[model samples]
Target: MNDPAIAVDGLTKQFRGGTRALDGLSLRVSRGGIYALLGPNGAGKTTLIRILATLLRPDGGTALVAGHDVVAEAGRVRQLIGLAGQFAAVDDHLTGRENITMIGRLYGLTRRAATSRAAEILTRIGLDTAADRQVKTYSGGMRRRIDLAASLIGRPQVLFLDEPTTGVDPASRHDLWSLVRDLAADGTTVLLTTQYLDEADQLADRIAVIDHGRLLTEGTATELKDRTGAAVVELDLPPHQLDAAMTALQPLAPRRDRDRILLPAPDGPLTLRHAMGLLDQADLTPTDIALHGPTLDDVFLALTRHNTSRSARSTA
Candidate 1:
């Protein structure tokens, strides 16, 4: 089998104030696939990314990027990876082309090579038309694409994106997503941290959810959803009928909120039909009814809920 593009084993880190940022985290990412890290704020996603990118040292264990130890072969690892952080890092005073050229030069390209590469990247990222405009004049999404273009100056084998689309408009975000897919298709392994669950659902070949410095779960989106083991049947009824609908759906252990009742539907359509029949028998008509498979949002909520519950119990 081929070596993983990135690997972590029992990785750990802690801050000066005793905040444990990572606790025995372990995972492997294969070559040519997008691996997304999902977590709430301060879940150590950034810390882990920084460590893997060789920007910060881990307190314990080890991390390898492209088969080189991050700590020992920091220089080699730097050469193998590209990092586009949460914020665009381009100099606002420089034009988009100049910014990319400067990065290429910094990566040790000749002046001519840097200029050529910069033009190539600007064209690739669809910023050629605005390439000569100062970064400050670019829209939020344009800045992001330019920053990403700079990261590719060295044509890295592995790329790390930290919240790559946090505040971009929807259209730009879609474009960035397409760019990422194209990069992975061309065999640049990607590791990204995202707050948007749907982004991870759409882009990641595999996802790892983390909370409180620990890995909560990891799997392909479908596999993670399957782990929830039941679809959700949502019923929208008149507010006055909520109580009656809840009682009728009692066997499914329905949860109620406002005018909607949500219940597990292990048998999917069969269970949905039974639920509607029960409501019919009770002379309660639903305004709307839908059956939805478990979503990434559901998986995230369940895993994070477990973390919260466990923390509360430990504190108690």
Candidate 2:
């Protein structure tokens, strides 16, 4: 098989306290696309990102970035990779332009070249108007944009973003999304670690879900959602009518949870009709109704629940 931009096999990491942070985690990311690494807190997402960025050493197994082994060719991997960690680590006193230029200089650019490159990147990130202002004076979004520009000083082949938009506002999040998409379109392979399911749904061509130090599943958003079966109809009936709705729905649908009525439906029209008909017969009136397909939430819940149950049974 041809080499992927990033690949890992049996990757394991144990911290100083002997806690297993990553256990046999393996993943593959093809070239020139966006791949979202998803997991809840303490699921080894950050550990894996640190290992891939050469910031932390894995105790066992191997990881490759841009076809270079992370252990043996750590320097080479660093040369071809750009990493933006979860925190915005920009020097607060430094202007946005100065920050990016400093990064360019660190990457071996001459003073003049670094200045020019910083200007170009600042413009690209839409921070040109604020380029000369101290980063401390910028909003959270501006700081993040500057940090992103700093990471791209050398136009790296592989970029690793660890929760890049964690504290950003909605508008800033949208800007970051556009920037990431443009980067992928320009053929930069992007690996993004995010807990936000909607971020993965909108940006990633494929997503890998991990939890409890293990990789659970990976596929396109739609493909992963499909694993859970079909669309769900959630009926928020009044508290008093909940029992009636549940009873009426359970017989006609695949599942019902509390006040929610879930049906394995291909489309909404027919399912809506049947559900309304049943409600009428049962003399039920719901306060709210929602139609939801197999969403990222469903996918995450299904995979993690399966893994948790399996682990529980094994320990028993």
Candidate 3:
């Protein structure tokens, strides 16, 4: 295949003190698409992102972003990409407009051009009215919007978002997703790192799961879920009979909570019916029961668990 918007081959990072932050991680993100790098904390997702952003050097392998080698063409790579890290990058002392303008100037835009571009970007991000407001006074969502605008000041071809919506409200998070979709639609490739599986499900055209500095798997949401081959069944048992309920649903039980039992139901409708019938036979009626397709959360848990077991044995 042609070179992807972002490509890495055996990229690795070994920090001082022998900390292996990245272990031969490989990934490919198609052009004009949104690729999500997802993993729990300490999984090297951030480290990989730092490497891609050219903030950290890798000890082995290579990373080419937007067809520019991250090491050999670091400056060119910087010109082609924008990064909005976990913390809002807006300076509290500066107004939203000033923040954008400052970044535009830093990118070498003329003063007049930077001002104009900053105005346009503020308007685009729905912050024109608050453009003159100090970032310290802006709400979390507003600051985030301003931060996003700053990243776009140079009109970079690729954008990197690291947990962009970690602390935003639900409504704001949804709004950000819409903005990201719009950017991708406009042909800007986005590589986002997030711990939220739902965020990946909603925004990612494809996802790469990383754990313990290694790439566990990468595929479209449906593709990854399909690999699991396990349908999820959620059942709510009567509060008092929850303990006994697990016994009756033993065949379908993979996990149990206070009043819910989770299990695999690969056969879908037929399997669900059989499970319900079995519960009925035991004279236990569920208040709620639902069947769901495989989710990214399931895939992450399954793959990471398997990897963990293998890693432990190898160490032994």
Candidate 4:
């Protein structure tokens, strides 16, 4: 295979007092694609990002960004990567254009080059109108866009975005998504870690789920959903009639929790039709019914739930 844009092998990190933040995590990201890492808080996503960004040292294992070892070649690796952290990192005292220009200068651009690049980036990020406004006067979303613009100053080969949309408004988040897509289309590799499942579903070419410092699974959204090998038929009925609905649908082996009954709908709408017929036979009328395939949320919940259950059993 061609060289991957990023590679990790047996990466491990342990904090003080024996908190294993990452354990033997390994993965490869192809060039020019968006790879998303999904995990609950404390699942080592940030740790991995920091390591790859050359901001943190790993206790064991190796990570290479743009073919430079993150540990041994930290300086070279840093030159090839851009990082937009979980929070905006712009200086509140500086104007938007000044912030980006400063970053360009830091990357060794000449004074004239930095100023020109700053103007280009400000326009690109749709912040040209706010170019002279102090960053403190910008809204949260505007600040985020400025921060992202700063990261692109060096034209990095690999970009790491750690929850880049976390407090952003819906409109700004949409803009950021478009920016990421444009970057990938231009052959920049992007690694994103986000709390939003829908964001991953919409933007990621591939996604990896992590828990307890280990990888649970990784694949495209459709592939991950298909691995579940089942669609769901959800029935919403009156609370008083839920039991009746579940009983009537028992032949379909429905699972009930609270007011909803979910059954495996292997035959898609045919299964929903059959379920409706059973409910009608029992004189039960569903307030709502729908048939849908497994979603990324379903895949995440199932994988994490299984991991938690296995951990419990092992401890017991």
Per-residue lDDT of model 3, residues 205-309, tens digit only: 999998878988899999999999888888887788787777887886557756688777888888889888888888898899899988888899888877887
For residues 1-316, could you state the per-residue lDDT of candidate 1 as single tens digits? 3999998999999888778889889999999989999998889999999999998999999899999999999999999999996646699999999999998899999999999999999999999999999899998889789889988988999999999998899999999999999999999999999999999999999999998778888999999999977888889999999998889888877888567888778899998999988998999999998999988977887789779878654322
lDDT (10s digit) by residue, model 4, range 1-316 = 3789999999999988778889899999988989999998888999999999999999999999988899999999989989996645578999998899888999999999999999998888899999999999999888788888988999999999999898999999999999899999999999999999999999999999998778989999999999987899999999999888888998898878578888878888999999999998999999988888888877887788788877654322
Per-residue alpha-carbon lDDT of candidate 2 for residues 1-316, written as tens digits (9 for 90 to 100): 3679999999988887666778898889999989999987888999998999898999999999988999899999989988886745579999998888888888899999999999999989999999999999999788778888988987989999998898899999999999999999999999999979999999999999998778898999988998877677777777788777877876555455665656655667678778878898998987887787878877787688678777754322
- Give all candidate RMSDs, comma-separated: 2.9, 3.5, 2.4, 3.0
TM-score of each: 0.88, 0.86, 0.90, 0.88
lDDT of each: 0.90, 0.86, 0.86, 0.90
Model 4 lDDT at residue 196: 96
Clashes of each: 0, 0, 0, 0
Question: What stretches of model 4 exceed 4 Å from their correct place?
Answer: 238-284, 312-316
What TM-score quantifies how close candidate 4 is to the native fold? 0.88
lDDT value, residue 256 of candidate 4: 80
Clashes of 3: 0
**Runs in model 1 lying further than 4 Å from the true structure:** 237-261, 267-285, 313-316
Cα deviation at 293, candidate 4, in Å, is 1.1
Candidate 3 runs further than 4 Å off? 243-253, 256-259, 269-284, 313-316
The TM-score between candidate 2 and the true structure equals: 0.86
